[model samples]
Target: MRWLDADEERAWRALRRMMIAIQSRTAHDLAAAGLSEPDYEVLSTLSERPGHASTLGEQAAKMGWSRSRLSRHATRMEARGLVRREPDPDDGRGCYLVLTEHGLRTLEDAAPAHLESVRRHVIDRLSSADLSALERIARKLEEPT
Candidate 1:
């Protein structure tokens, strides 16, 4: 396999830096609002769907997290009244994570600042053509082999 040459390596490093900075800034901003990025994602995702509930496995997969990580986070949030755990009716051994009313309200409060951070760090940094290019590259990278 051909390794990346100097220019490609430099570009890869730049992309990595941008990715890290974007995530860091967003997480920091969310932290100020009393939420983590993962918390925002979980809350928003559940609120986006009907029933406001998803199985533990489903939540883990959606967040690209392990089941244990999801469970641990959910436990913390549950204690804070952000969510609740319930038995999954269809699967005897499975469980669901349901977003509580408090979680929904918290997510709504955080959305504006979260969106502004994203726009300022990423969206506003790119031109329309660059945005399209980024979309294409990102989609390609996400494709299954």
Candidate 2:
């Protein structure tokens, strides 16, 4: 296998650093808003659907999470009055994840701060050309190898 040249290695490290920086900055913002990354992920995903409700399987798939992970997180959210699970009438084994009013409120409150952090840490750092380049690079990386 070929190794990166010094310049390539430096760029690789910069990319890695940027990822960590983005995660940490947004995490700090979320923490200040009384949320963890998992909480944010669950809430944000559910918020995309009308009424903030989706089948458990769909939520899990959309978030790239395991059913067991979703189950565990949902259980905790349920206990906190953030969400509720309803049986899917068409399928005895299926259930719908419903975000409660409290959940929506919390997410709404956190979104502005979260968006600001994202903008500060990522979006505002790039020029339009750089942003376009990054999108292209990310899309390339996302393609099936």
lDDT assessment of candidate 1? 0.91
Stretches of candidate 1 exceeding 4 Å from the true structure: 1-3
Per-candidate local distance difference test: 0.91, 0.92
- For candidate 1, write residues 1-145 as lDDT tens digits: 9999999999999989988988999999889889998889889888866799999999888878899999999999999999999999999998999999899899989999999988988899899999999999988977778
* Candidate 2: pairs in clash: none
**lDDT tens readout by residue for model 2, 84-143:** 999999899999999899999999999999999889988999999999999999989777
Estimate the Cα RMSD of every predicted model relative to the unseen true structure: 1.6, 1.7
- Please report the TM-score between candidate 1 and the true structure: 0.91
Model 2 lowest lDDT segment of ten: 135-144
